[model samples]
Target: MAMSRNEILDQVKEVLVDALGLDEDEVTEGATLMGDLGAESIDFLDIVFRLEKTFGIKVPREELFPAESLMNNPDFVSGGKLTPKGLAEFKARMPHSDFSKFEANPDINKLTDLFTVAAVVNFVERKLNQAA
Candidate 1:
């Protein structure tokens, strides 16, 4: 048996609420982990650990958050914004994220927007399906 999307989202919310010290209502599908929920880099580790423990799935840090690598590459990033190549790589790497708004400005600071609660749910759902 597989968990439904809502179930996955509920678990993700729990993870975020505990890991980020957030109220349940703050962890909405559209909530950006960093921007909206105030999740620092360290919180991500706790979130991943909790998600893995809760779901019994391996959660790779880079697999879920590939921004660090992409941001450092000159070809991918220049002038504090993502180059076209960077955008392409981001799209490939962050398939779970919504790129519509980011594609417009492509500002490096906006990279945090890519890490939404829904994206976490999507990644967990994909990982669980793969395990199944």
Candidate 2:
């Protein structure tokens, strides 16, 4: 059976709390990842790695760090800042055609509650598949 939205969110929160060393209560859906979570670029990459390990997904380097044009999108954001809600919304909006097949698939439509763990895992898994 597929995981429930709450289940995914809870897992995402747990991953963030453990990986980023933040208190569980601090990681709300609207919290800013960089501003609130104190995650630098390297830390973000580490989170990506942890996600991949947890969910067996791969994300592309280009996708992970897209060009400025792609960066301009609200979904992509400025200053490496991402709100948990925004991240969830972006995942929900991604089309199947936008990503390569073979990575671990999570319920992006339910992503508003999905959080970063599943998304990061899906991204890293996609990258790994591309490299294979």
Model 1 misses residue 5 by how many Å? 0.1
Model 1: per-residue lDDT, tens digit, 69-129? 7788999999999999989999999888999998999999999999999999999999999
Best of the candidates, TM-score:
1
Give the TM-score comparing model 2 with the true structure, all chains together.
Answer: 0.51
Instruction: Please state the error at residue 3 of candidate 2 in Å.
Output: 0.9
Clashing pairs in 1: none
What are the per-residue Cα lDDT tens digits for candidate 2 across 25-105? 997755545655777667767766765666555644345433323335665453454444444444444421133221233
Worst 10 residues of 2 by lDDT: 95-104
Q: lDDT: which candidate is best?
A: 1
Total clashes in model 2, counting residue pairs 3 or more apart in sequence or in different chains: 11
